[model samples]
Target chain A: MLQVFPDLKGRYGDFGGKYVPETLMGPLQELEEALDQAMADPAFLEEYHHVLKEYAGRPTSLSYADKLTGHLGGAKIYLKREDLNHTGAHKLNNAIGQALLAKRMGKEKIIAETGAGQHGVASATVAAKFGLQCIVFMGEEDIRRQELNVFRMKLLGAEVVSVSSGNGTLKDATNEAIRYWVANCEDHFYLIGSVVGPHPYPRMVRDFQRIIGDESKRQFLEVEKELPDRIFACVGGGSNAMGIFYPFLGDTSELIGVEAAGKGMDTPEHAATLSKGTPGVIHGSMTYLMQDENGQITEPYSISAGLDYPGIGPEHAHLFQTKQVRYEAITDKEALDALKLLTQMEGIIPAIESAHALAQAFKEAPQMSQNETILINLSGRGDKDMATLMEHFQEEV
Target chain B: MLTKTSFQGKLTKTEDLFIPFIVAGDPSPELTIQFALRLQEEGADVLELGVPYSDPLADGPTIQRAAQRALKSGMSLRKAIELVPKLREHGLEIPVVIFTYYNPVLQIGHEEFFQLLGENGVEGLLIPDLPFEESEEIRNRSEEKGIEFISLVAPNSDQRIKQIAEHAKGFLYCVSSLGVTGERKEMSAEALAFIEKVRQYSQVPVAVGFGISTNDHVQLVRNHADGVIIGSKIIRLIEAEIENIEKGRMDEALKHFTKEIRALVQ
Candidate 1:
């Protein structure tokens, strides 16, 4: 089912496709061809895996949350520790893989758009390592929010361009990046951060990130000798969620994706695109997106910069529509509370993006039997979110 | 529904074509028709009326600002298409093409959207994001409705130029630069070669756009292309006169606008 899904046109059901300017069609075709040849090459695959293990620190452990599970008092909880990766997120896996693809294609310059700055840092890290010129497009709002990551990216020799259009967020940054890529596509490679863009991108990024599920599935089977009852991961552009959910897709384990309900699903502020959104085209993919009656994309709000996107990945939209995965939304307050709970109980500071999934797991875990287990992808660390965290939890702290 | 001559037919009658693009309802709805008429009077063989969108990928800052003002004036794809008959009623005789992104069309769907273009006085439709490979459904529907769905070919479209030009309907759009819709100080040599390359395979007329601004830029492209499209520069001119247009001084503003337009094209 997974093999034949995207098909030739890159549609996951009625979702992803190459809806870009004519200037990009040639570049996109060139990229698709290069990626195909690179993926088929054993040497390329070996280098990607080798870098993941040696540099990015792959095989992130699946740790049993005994204390948190005891406090929740229902379902056993286990975390796939992606926060332990070198760049402190699952984003490096795709970044390293794509940067290697850029090198293989003989492209010297790479450009990317980042929301929470995780992908920016990862892309900058890989560029510095490979001696390639790196330019990362970030929203002015995000740069103000994630100051440390911005500094880290610059320290790693990446040029960060601040995009000030349309509420100054991930959507605007992506637009600027694509705009730049369209002009400079002859020499530069656009390293898309998530699984949301045009065809082959969603597929290629997912294949790079699928290692999360592959490792967790084997490790979980080793420890418990049985598959977990459910898997929970946060969905921004749904990259990390898709990563952890892809392997368990055909399994009996229930796969649930959590979206950022900034204020609430009833309000216009939430980023729960699949919940309240209609099917529309954004960033070249036809997916569930927050848009107006005239089909103009609306600004999405969320406490977590990573999950503030107005659209979900097309594959997630397909999985959502097909009922292959259940989607739930967590409010900013709920995620904050869950973040505090994990920090106090398990001594782990989870990224606010991942806390959306954690909060959902806590809700469902308490309703389930004690033998049932929940596996959540701790997608990133909370270090970059220090300023936002301090601002939100000032009184409590 | 209004039936009219195609933009390609205009190319046959006149050797040199100048298509001026302006965002519909830039400052106000009434002014849009007036501005379009002014361009029509200034030897504009075709007028491309842009449906103002919140996210316009191919547009530069100048045009993006125009779209912002247009959207603020309650302009939409539906509203822009509806504005075409009004332009005709106000005596806009030249061919009019609606330039829009793909999302609004996806929202309106193909069947009704094409029908709207036919019902209105629209002759051509150009969606920048819908390239040749993804334009199959749209191109087919436009053919059935007799609406020319214009094809766009860029400098990078080296080997793929043949495929895009094979079924080119009205005129093959030759992007004059590797960038988005904006003005440029100078056009590149590769762009000239690309225009010549597209001419080899194209059956219809060839129009060059995207940075075809300034007299030097226009003159250089004029030698290699059949038509030259100017977008951002015209928008920039109108934007500079937003105050006078709003003060009901349309005549005074348009006189100055015409002089500037003539300075570049003539």
Candidate 2:
């Protein structure tokens, strides 16, 4: 079989490198070699695959969005229901893999950073199942807005620390998590919650979550008997996109990554990194980031907590530069409209982050030909976003 | 006392001059310019004006806190460049080195940056992230424009030490340790041993950086290496002061911090 994971040193087209401090060098190397050995071990893969199937529920179905298709009027659409996963998103696939890896490595604690709190909740749940200590870093503002996920994490026995500095948001939380991990490198394993970070992580998360694409490819062929003409997913830290895009990447399918167009790309209140940001190295890898003259990270703003970040994952940066995928963004208002439309019409209350993919489908479907098949990853359920959406639409009602 | 070129020449002669780095917009880019002048006044042989990147991988909490303050002040690349001309207009003649990452340098094109810096009376450059292998174009262009491009070598790496020592013109920045820059009480014995090893190979003068915080650290390296690079520790001093004082009190507080570092060198 073809090799999926990169070597101990992460190199994805001149973008990924092990730009970590000296202390992390040993553990990362150990993790890399351990993971390499574990991948080949039938027992490890059997245990992981069994848990994903019996416990977490794998092979999530692909539902055709006929109502969304009729509304858009140009092409037929389908939804890859990753929302049907045990954690209501595709994050569990990778989180389960990493948690198992942590157990094998004898790591007693799990550390992660969350923006929308989905990854944190997933990590917290997996940590509880594995009986490992978990600590999650979240922005102070996110703690208030994503209260349900915060409480869920606490209930699952994970301690959630609120970061108050540097805009008090996702990027700042990530920075704080890195600082914490540096001090506790001997005992704690940083789960990194997304496809970004130093090395090994970007590759590891993608390989674990490739189940989304693998299932979608086989399911689509069985259902429609043809490949998708286009595939769409949102790009906040880009794990879900990597999940769905990996199997389709080699195929002749057009991949579209929608980012948050907060107010507008022209203003500072946007999180459309791939569309507006320049190529720069940050957080131990080179990637596209929203930066100022001295290369200080600027504050990113979006209605969706999940989509607000200064930089994209390094692999996505490589993909964007190589033109393998076309990157675009939808405004917060546009995403909210799609959320309401999907909930009211299709009876699917999609998560605000997933609604970003819905909004892109809304835009691109109209331009596509009648025969074009667009597959959108409905990544998470909207149960956690009800309060946020209600508050956003409060002025109207 | 000298022109920027001649000062750069002296820097190249010894191959090491104690170049003190402070974030350009940390306290405010306006005051940062004043701070640069003060460092010159206190005998900072070369001025390293750090561009205050938000995600400073190599720095500790002190510099990170200062960067947060600088970003809040609406600091931009244009404003940082504008300060170069602003300082030169005020007659601060030391070789002002723009110590920055490769992103901003690439954002504003290479030729355009050199032209802007040339117009602003800047004379040297030090980018810690840009290794010698990937810096040939920038190095060639910088040398052609009479701006001495500085390079860094890890303490015990024989190849990097020799490569940097041979081609290094302005100064050789010898990283004191293998980790990020921070404050610590005493220098490591291994670091001292590495510094001794580098001094043997380095034809140009070498300056020890990365956690050289105390006066004792400065004095210890003063014998083996030509100078000391103090960054995060000095920035930490000003960050600690900002919460207590009013806006007008910052200059006095910053001046006191500079005075303490200058006193260490004396």
Instruction: Find the candidate with the highest DockQ and give its number.
Output: 1
How do the residues A207-250 of candidate 2 rate in per-residue lDDT, one tens digit apiece? Answer: 88888999999999998899999999999889999989988876
Going through the candidates in the order shown, the clash numbers are 0, 2
Tens-place lDDT digits, model 2, residues B1-266: 11222434545435335678888787776777767777777778877887766665555677777776777787765577668888877767777778776666767878898888777767778765566655788999988888878877764344456666677756667766523235544456677677776667655567778776667667667766777787877676656656633556766776686777677666
User: Which pairs clash in model 2?
Assistant: A293-B77, A296-B54
Lowest summed lDDT over 10 consecutive residues: which window, candidate 1 chain B? Answer: B1-10
Instruction: DockQ each candidate and list the results.
Output: 0.76, 0.19
Best by lDDT: 1
* lDDT string, candidate 1, A101-192, tens digits: 99988899999999889999999999999999999999998888888889999999999999988778899999999999998887899999
Residues forming the 10-long window of minimal summed lDDT in candidate 2 chain B: B1-10
Candidate 1: residue B167 Cα off by (Å): 0.7
